[model samples]
Target: MNNQDDIILRTDNLTKRYGGVHALEEANFTLKKGEHVAIVGDNGAGKSTFVRQITGVEQPTSGDIFFEGKRVEFNSPLEAREAGIESVFQDLALCNDLDVPSNLFLGREELLFKFGPFSILDEKKMMRKAKEVLERTAIKIPNLSNHVGDMSGGQRQCVAISRSASFASKLIIMDEPTAALGVQETTQVENIIRGLKDQGVPLILISHNLRQVFNLVDKIWVFRRGRIVGEVIASETDGNEIVSMITGMQGGVHEKASYI
Candidate 1:
């Protein structure tokens, strides 16, 4: 990555507090267009808060968020989505009872006006779009009408990812994307992530799985005590060092906690 180029998103003096608890503290972060960045930390280390601010799921008590070189304040996640930011949370926001295509095009449904002012959902068009989007990531769904509840964990995750890719124009943030999957399923989801990367959609991945983080992200940012402790390029660091930081054995400000 070059020091001089376009930046898609950045934060300055970002802070978030709940009552007296600081979830994020004066953290500065950046994401370059087409870059895949991973954030890892132990529980209560502010990973979720950081992503919440970035995705506009929660407002930062203080700080300015920049998107595509312009300062913007997002009041809600919908605002962020309108600005071309899509997120896949750990829950994936999937509808268990709905079919794959329905879940894929959930909120943003297509409307057809066969009668003026009395429009109905255009299911065929949405199904076609769903199939196309799923294919973009090489996700093989034998039937688009299958209920998501019946799909394998990996397939459900892929559907969620595909939905984000289908809607996101600039960035996608995924939180604990493969947390409940088996090894094979996790790899399937990782391949979908790689496909997203190849297509130039910058992604922010929030995961505690160091091995997955190392294998998928180009860079890793470590968080401790609601603050960013360090940022390391994947080529320059390993999971053991990051895990040590997460446990406070070693990092920006703590170096004596104990790695052994």
Candidate 2:
């Protein structure tokens, strides 16, 4: 059982709808501090929708979101970030033409000097901070001055993950973080995640890779047909059991399942 005081994020009866179709339904979920959890299911199973609502990419049709013991209604992703919730979507949202430091700072650039109506961007400061952030996350990018467009898929993914980790004070949400990477690159990203875990940072990972999910997270939340079918402790359950839960083959175990 998880202590209520340790809960960093909680959703009560969370639901989302579009016209006549329900994208998500009545989800009661809790994530504790420093805990890593995975959300997995087949396509159209509401995994992305649930994440969108939580990250403020979209509003819930009904229900409440509680973060760090306070009820929150995030009007935008910026608001969510201000509340210490950062997300790295599969799209990456980085400017390919920009350099590493620029991409890391993106919309939140720093200003160092001002003259009249003109202000100079703090490029050096941004680069220094970017290096610090990468080092802290144990992310290795051989060339920090190269354009992201020229980088490999895994490198780009690492930049996105690093950006999220740089400012995230509470939780980081990653959607298909390693879906497009090679084996070596995937290992690098996974190592970065492990570094986050070592630092006691909480994370929520959404992925179709059952192996990665089982290896990286402590708990698994199975979603099926817009609803969470089960929550299983990773150490206590196998991939087959999780697959069974996702397909609805196993019933009546969700309520009684023990989760950390």
Candidate 3:
């Protein structure tokens, strides 16, 4: 909020297109240090598309991304993670067949030997570390030996979030984190989000739940028709104002369309 130095992430005219159809167009957005912001809109409003671009799941057609005051163009999700950006998509991306520890250390497994493909897994060590991560995030999974597929939806969602929180050094992004969850499960996930805020970790949450958005984030960014239409402080705005922006009915209809 102070200046560019205070910004953890910033995008200048970020755009994405498929043929002539623009999924996301010139979306200029920002997140400051230790701030939580939500992206809310109707379907096809470009929330996920914008997130995909930021997480390096897809390259932007044209834009400059600044993270921690340095310009960066990530070629893949791996690159983005290495640069301290971790994302939890809707799929959760956990290995269903693998047990909790294995899923937690899926790609970054510990090895007893220095071998590549033939390396012996240090299963005990990975399990210990996984337990530590779960504890740190206040996530409870009774048995670390249980296959992730055997767990309930909420536990699996917690695992995905725990994994992201454990490794995210700079920023964490969540897309529809609680869309598939029920009331109890949603509360569990929301508590985890609050934990992230307590740690002062900056986050970008994409959610359609205005109630949840109002409860969690410091600011709300409304997207309409592939473009970022408006931003408002969460404490100062209500659901109706945000709904108006999403439906292009805030200003006159044509006036809102002018952003596109």
Candidate 4:
């Protein structure tokens, strides 16, 4: 087992409920420093619900979240981002009317005068920083002036990921990042994910594609009926075993993979 000091994120008995519906229950999860982990489950299996709690999109009914070894309860997604947890939700979250640079610095725009809403933005500086971020992630975009809504699906996805890569200091969480892209576009996004791994950034990916999960992450966590059913080392397990865990099929391995 990794030392406690090596843990980047952890949750203990995290639970969320709405009236009689329990969206997530007793989720105990962890991600080690520089490790990439995938969360896989079928629809309504509490995968996104778990992510919502971690990213501060919604508060849990009861739980504890530890980041960098410190307990925290973020009041909002903005607070989570400010605390160095960046997320690329399935929607991409880019403003349709904004150009590349503007969207890259959306909520955290670079201001010239530090005035509240009246301050003038340093467009040139923001563009330069955006370029550096894209270059570092090896993302190629032809024009910075193009509106995000006008770009291809893959390019827009890259923009969202680049925004996260630029600002995330501790960890990155991605939900269905390549769900709607074509083959080439999916490849592009996957390559960017690999780039993040190469940079030693810890990531928690929520995906349905077992192939992609095996390709990109070091470990997999399976969720079933609002609970984590199993955890496995990606290299030590196969898709069949993961599928059985997800579906709870008979004669399938349900035990956690040996980490030692």
Candidate 5:
């Protein structure tokens, strides 16, 4: 079992290179259990690249990843999820034709029975579980049977978040989760994030919206030119200071607190 004070995820000298291009270079980062962290950067700041390496969408050119006090190497996204790390990307990764329950149990559908060579989906069980999960997260979808394609952007985003939260046992990573959402929808998503914090679920959020970052996360990790330029406690800093750090206008004061 992981202690509350344990480092849930840590990257040491993490780097990724494509030929001569250095997408991410020597990033040392840590996320503690139940801590909410935000990754912010301008375009091409290697934010997505960092997420890709950790999520097993791509291999790091060099470095080590430690999770829950154990070193791990995830060869695919499935491996990451199996290790109790769930990510909800901007795309949401839902089947437009499927309903909420189907999307929630997409790849790992519950099996009702197996006959010879066929196994059937336990959809009723999945639907019940889905409703429970949404309730736990304080998320309300008026119709769980509605197809994803018919739902509004915010509803779709909530479905993706609900799926991740339902299955995630260790950490949850969200990439621009509210970028396409309207004000009301964004508020709804923020409430879900707050609910996660109250539940003591560690989260890593990647976003460019400074207001949301300041409101939702405890710490901010700024990336610039393929490198992590700074890590600031949200309570001690503001958007201007973070923006300066991102633009390399000022040197970041490295906090003396132990990171990993």
Candidate 6:
């Protein structure tokens, strides 16, 4: 945990439930601006649910969410995005039939006057911006004209990450970012993540890869079932200790670790 001044996003007594089934049990979390935090948990834990609530995919049953310095409620993902919260879900939400530029600018496209009363998509402008975003992120792909269907898993993931990072001004939520990537591809994606970190993008990465989490994040938040159980600064703890906490061996150790 870092100092309170560094925290940019936080949830107080956040909770969610599905038809009387409590999916999240008053879980709390805090993220500092420009800080990289990893959320690690098992299958049944509320990591996904917690993320869903924060991103406006689902609403919390009871809680308070604060972004920047204002407390607010988001009714939809777009609302969350408008508030500078971007999420890269495990599905990666890329249209396979579309080209790199098309996928990058999906839903939000550039348009210019064509006929007297009608406008057409400005493909050239969108492609230029897409290329610029890719270059800025140091991402390499086959070509901007290449169809996403023809791309490898890692390439598609990079596009997804880049799309989120492009609009993300404060926070980026990544769920299982490297779940299906190969060795080389994982390295590439990891480098892209580091690049975002270098630019001071705050991230909440949900992963099962202990090595990746320990190596990249400034802090780790461990979740068990539906509650946040522990949080440890990456520099102050080892993977083994985190593993023990995740498996129920340790008890509320991180309660003392929350500085912000």
Please report the candidate that would top TM-score against the real structure: 4
RMSD per candidate (Å) reads 3.4, 4.4, 4.0, 3.8, 5.2, 4.9
Model 1 spans with C-alpha error above 4 angstroms: 1-5, 114-118, 251-260
lDDT of 5 by residue, 147-253 (tens): 98999898899999998988856899999999999998989899888988999999999998888899999999999999999989999997778877877766453
* Residues 1-260, model 1: lDDT tens digits: 64536789989989999999999999999989899999888889999998899888899999889999889888898889889999999888899899988898776778876555566889999999998888877767789898999988888999988888888569999999988888887887898889888989999998877777878889999999899998999889766678777777655534343321
In model 2, pairs of residues that clash are none
Task: Give the range where candidate 3 is weakest over 10 consecutive residues by summed lDDT.
Answer: 251-260
Best by lDDT: 4
Model 2 per-residue lDDT tens digits across residues 138-207: 6567878999999989889989999998885689999999988999999989998998898899999999
State residue 109's C-alpha deviation in candidate 6, in Å.
1.8
Worst 10-residue lDDT window, candidate 5:
251-260
Residue 45 error, candidate 2, Å: 0.6
lDDT of each: 0.86, 0.89, 0.89, 0.90, 0.89, 0.86
Give candidate 5's whole-model lDDT.
Answer: 0.89
- Cα lDDT for residue 165, candidate 5: 87
lDDT by residue for model 6 (1-260), tens: 55667788999999998998888998878898899999988787899999999999988999999888678799998899888898899999899999988887776678886564456889999999899888876767858898998988988999999898886568999999999999988998888889889999999999999889988999999998898999899999976678767777666455344221
For model 3, residues 156-207, the per-residue Cα lDDT tens digits are 9999998888875699999999989989989989998999999999999999
Q: Which regions of candidate 3 fall more than 4 Å away from where they truly are?
A: 251-260
- Answer with 2 or 6, whichever has the higher TM-score: 2
Error of 2 at 125 (Å): 0.5
